[model samples]
Target: MDTTPIAAGTGHAEAAAGGGVRVGALVPLSRPGWVEAGRQLLAGLELGVGDVNRGGGISGRPLELVVRDTAADPAKAAAAVEELAGTGVAAVVGEYHSVVARAAAAQADALGVPFLCSSAVLDALTDEPTEWVARIAPAQSRGWRIFADFLLGAGHRRIAVAAEPSVYWAAGARILREHLAPRGGTLVELDARALGPAALCDELVAQRATALLLLVGTPEPAVPIVTSVRHDPRLADVLIGAPAGQPEFAEWASLLGGDGAAIPFLRYLPEHLSPLGARVEAALRERLDEAASFVAFEGYDTIAVLAEALRAHHGTRTKAADFWPHVTAEGTRGTISFSRQPALTAWQWTWPPIQVADRDPANPTRFRVLHTG
Candidate 1:
């Protein structure tokens, strides 16, 4: 229970004295970005550790978490990984930002430590040939493809993509275009960064687009865009899709108020909840005192996967390459397998489950799962 802040340069002699397996958790705890998300991930990490410790703790030895604050910066994230390596953590987990996770993965590879990326969806994160890096979340391209399929299956021919100028959004927009074009569908690309929300909505309506995809980076732009489109009577039939960015958060529905109703978004886990998922959600809700998000579930699952691998190896520090086979075979969310295709790297979770969900008008806290793939 004693979580004394360990300085970056400190030795791990004290932490290892009790024969516990130290696991490093790298998250953006400081400000300037993603503070809430980092906290939620940490909460899940702690809960998973608690559950592991309760159930005889990894070959009867306790699991200790060494926390490091990445502050959402790539350089800091890389440094955190190096520091965690020096501190002698058996493995590392928990990074929400894609850029930060990419940098940290490189550091972990160099250090020869296993890194379980919790929520970063960048395709290139797993594209590099590194045995040290593994991802529990699906790649962004896969999520975009899921969204594209959902839109097209609903008989939508004309699709419009409104995206901000960022690597994540750009990648998503590109995937949408490629998938839709081949299926005899047309895509209208709009730069939400260049145009205000009202202007973007006006342009989308003018295009007579049957489906509008918002790939904006944050909720700031998405809120107004969804609100504008939902309120307009002219765009009543248009399906407004907020893929990957804002709608994933639990706060999105409350922020958008009634306008958030019936707007579909890409979700890794279903809101209706599986039995195991319900138990995890209940624990998180008790700890956080509010509804838990998908990121929290991801954080818990990352640790669960790592613990499963560790237990299989009898608490020994397994090599990154050796560890993933066990993970792919025994992962909690079905089988956490990977593909070695050239487009994807060795550690990418190839068979990740995805769903298109929209908020319930009567209960903003719950999402109605429209389609699962």
Candidate 2:
């Protein structure tokens, strides 16, 4: 695709031929980030852009993406937003890390640039609600509560969380705790950062926890903890869980093989897909050469929403976020629409489907949906 440079305040009606309506894509493709998740997200976004162009792109010009790697750093993400804003992108989209997305959202809001967050479920995405930003992913509070409910229904009253010290992980642990407290459930926090996987397993055993939730990064504390717990005879009956959807990616199975199975996690996919969703999922699977996670679907939905916003006003680039309240696009998971939700200032999808699922122990690569919300 050609790299088309857009000037700020430019309109599709005023532009000549051969110029692309550029959208900035922020993704973490490098180390220290979840590179697999980032790749899945980019695949969906790229496909969405292709579909947009094929369907008569903004005001007849092709839609282009100006890609930037955030690398899961909040400061780096903010910097990318600044650079994209200066490059005259009509809107900025895509991010996987909650911490980084929060930073990017703040910067985009301050600069008055429209941002469509593809993933990252942090409930407090911004200090205050602004019209400049919106999100496609369900919030952490909402998703985690469903996970808690799943655990309770499965008869796990004593749950333990092996958590790393990070704002995102901390927030998830808090959400789980808050949701479980009133329901006669208990949450035990084991410091994954301080305790090694072996020691973490020991704590789980000592606590008599029926289930262990992983609230840490992959390959580090999460993977090792799963290994230790699965091998320990004392933890034989203890269920392992990842409410942040860690096991949805391929890497988890590659690392733990059969051990990664049955570690239920939160996922944002409906039991059934719309017609558009099924087609996109097939395309995404071909593009990714694997089963695509919900994040990839979010990438497509993000662009779908933004495309409608841009098309609503005959391809007006200025005040792109003004299109948020009006955009209604058919997304992979469901009908995509943004509204001012309660307790949030940013435009929210109000909901996306939520599910609790895990890899099937009988077939490590296959997922078995256990619960839905």
Candidate 3:
């Protein structure tokens, strides 16, 4: 199993001569996971690792990634962290699923290993505060609140969410509910599993919801629900939304085509990229053979921050005081840094830039920024 990152530029031989700084990457690459998202995330992580090596190999030592497939399973993530800890990785990074990241974060903290979580937005990553883990993504509450605000701006005072059972979805619903209630808005929850696409549409009509938000899985219920609603005569004026970012992947457009556009979702990115962000975005497009999602940028920024922290602290792994204060790096999105937040159980980025965006109906591949926060 060659679990090495794709080396970019001309520092391979030099890097190899100085041994490698091992970082464990937990990604969901197979079935039951969002494979496309995992691939994009890995591309960014690998690109960041390559750039670090090219910039003199993390203090003259090669950086290597030990990859593990979580498959969106929390148990697998926990076990992978245990294995990675035993294998002497300086830190663990990269996970797109919030539940899986929570499991990995717990395991990493238990084993006293540092984990710079790449893209999980769950508000409470741990039950309590611990320095063993920090995150690059905004908390679910923060992002969802912004998403809820977008809905309000669009005049959706009566919103309905077809939500599946999951801590992530439940948390998002709660955030929307809380954020909306005091602002003269309301959120109505619908059981996604109990309602077929037709039933879901009927309920949307009966509830008189101005907008229908999807807090369900992609393709199965979400795609079908969108299709049903888009085709339904009674729901013609109802807006469809997916704030958890289902439409950010190419698969959504492939499956839904024109029906998938204009469905707003949350993404962590500035309207414009920094110089470093633009360069990385170009490289990522070439590397991915498609436009990269924000999750991928999170992965790349994870490595960039970790590499600088490692260099500042002599390439050591898992030291809270050492890495926490030294992680200011020029990321693809914005200057990345971490601080303790009241709402999060992990050290948060205070927030990465957040946006509410959607695919242009005329061009499914092209994203149009609808709102920024």
Highest TM-score: give the candidate number: 3
TM-scores of all predicted structures? 0.88, 0.95, 0.96
Q: List the residue pairs that clash in candidate 1.
A: none
Q: Model 1, range 48-95, lDDT digits (tens) per residue?
A: 877777777778767778888888888988988888788777888889
Ranking by lDDT: 3, 2, 1
Question: In model 3, which residue pairs have backbone atoms overlapping below 3 Å?
Answer: none
Which one is best on lDDT? 3
Question: What lDDT would candidate 2 get against the real structure?
Answer: 0.87
Q: Residue by residue across 264-356, what tens digits does model 2's lDDT show?
A: 999999999899999999999999999989999999999888888888766556663456888898888888898877777678897999999
Q: What range of 10 consecutive residues in model 3 has the weakest lDDT sum?
A: 1-10
lDDT winner, 1 or 2:
2
